[model samples]
Target: MSATAISTDVYTQVQQFYARQMHALDACRFDEYAATFTEDGEFSHTPGRPAAHTRDGIARELRAFHEERFATEPVQRRHWFNMIHLIEAPDGSLRSTFYVLVVTSRPGERQPEIAPSCVVHDVLIRADGGLLNRSRRVEHDYLLDLKRT
Candidate 1:
């Protein structure tokens, strides 16, 4: 498909898909978040870790990561996302570059502070007349050294 095929309606649907993705993640809805991806989706976030492939694999990886984070940090974490650019790939997929800001706040903290500003690259495909992510990768602006105690 040509770029011209990416009409306003398709664009709007893509945006909505992203919105739902962020909402699901923020709410810790792993199942819903996994649903945003295709059955054979892939996810890569942390360095040196193997990428999660398939919807079930994605859910398992996220659940383990979030559980570990919540258990150790004792802080509330929130994720905010904004689409910076959306391009139609030659294969008809939508390639998006987005900003992800993760905020962390202690129970009695004055304000929530940024944990990391991450750039996310996602390949979205049209499935069942809706957009679903085929692959997603994230790189953080800051070092994620959790052993800094």
Candidate 2:
């Protein structure tokens, strides 16, 4: 495939991967959510939080964190992506940068708070079947009380 075509293909695959991930989270499918990444993939929150290196590690940590943090109340979370820029690296890996708006709705809340809207920088490797996320970094523009704590 041409360079342009390869980039487009990779972009589409990554977009689908992200959509599935969001779907898993929205549907409260914690296991599936954790399965979206590679075995050695890393997910980083904002500036200070340490990156989780493996799916099992992240799942265990996030399960505890989410239950403790959100078990008291119900909330809805949605992640929206825009302006995705993809580049094919020399080693056949792909790098993508995009903007994401995460909105969370709380019970009895008048309006859902749109927060953590920022740029997402990611590196993905083309595997045998599909794209595997090698690294993901989320840079939040602003933080808000989106999740009910």
Candidate 3:
């Protein structure tokens, strides 16, 4: 398969997938968020931290994020992705790269504030009639140099 320019329908499908996944996550529906991934999906965020593997592990990590970040505050989170680029792997999977901008705001706040922005690379495969993430790597802008010596 080649990395040719994708059709509008394909782009819209991928965009809708992200919309559902992010909404589930921000709504604190861990299982729904995990369902977006394959059973053996892997997710990595920080440079030094180990990647979380499997749907269960990914759900656990999301739970931890909610506890550590959201539990302490009254803020609601919204995740946005844009500038998507796609490539087709030889094995038939799709490689998707995009920028993620997360916004957070309290209930009484009049404005939302941006959280750390990130570039995410994901390997997506067709599973059970839809796209499922096989792997995801998130690189936060501020930590872009974290891997440098």
Candidate 4:
């Protein structure tokens, strides 16, 4: 195959990985969600929020927050990723920026509200012919009270 074709294929695989990660998170499948990242992955959900520097750290932080949210409100969150811009970096990693819209609703609620639209910046590393997220930084459209949660 040509070089361009190989690059396109790699990009497609990374897109699929992103989709699967979102689905796993919505389903509360922690292990599956964590597997989408590299062993030394890093996640910063918001500017003032604490960042997780390892796969296990991400899992623990996400699980605790999500479990608490579910317990308090009984709401389900749906994540939508769109407008993905991907570029191959000089270091052979992929740099991506994507918009995310999360809709949250409780059971039997008539209207689902958008939780905060955000843009995610990611550095994806190719490993074993597959791409895994090395780092992700999320910038939200609205301000959050970091001290609360």
Best by TM-score: 3
Task: List per-prediction Cα lDDT, in the order shown.
Answer: 0.83, 0.78, 0.87, 0.83
Candidate 3: where is the Cα deviation over 4 Å? Answer: 46-48, 145-149
What TM-score quantifies how close candidate 2 is to the native fold? 0.82
Better of 2 and 3 by TM-score: 3
lDDT of 4 by residue, 1-149 (tens): 11222367776787799888999989888778888899999988855559987888898988877766577678788999998888777677788899999999888989999978898999998888777889999998776346754
**Residue 113 Cα positional deviation in candidate 3, in Å, after optimal superposition:** 1.8
Candidate number of the best lDDT: 3
* Model 2 lDDT tens row, 34-111: 777788888886556677879887677667666876799888888898898887777887788899988889989989
Candidate number that wins on TM-score, 1 or 3? 3
Taking every candidate in turn, the Cα RMSD to the unseen true structure, in Å, is 5.4, 6.2, 2.7, 5.9
Candidate 1 local distance difference test against the native: 0.83
TM-score, structure 4 vs. true: 0.86
List the candidates' TM-scores in order.
0.83, 0.82, 0.90, 0.86
Residue-pair clashes per prediction, in order, are 0, 0, 0, 0
Candidate 1 vs 4: which has more TM-score: 4
Q: Cα RMSD for candidate 3?
A: 2.7
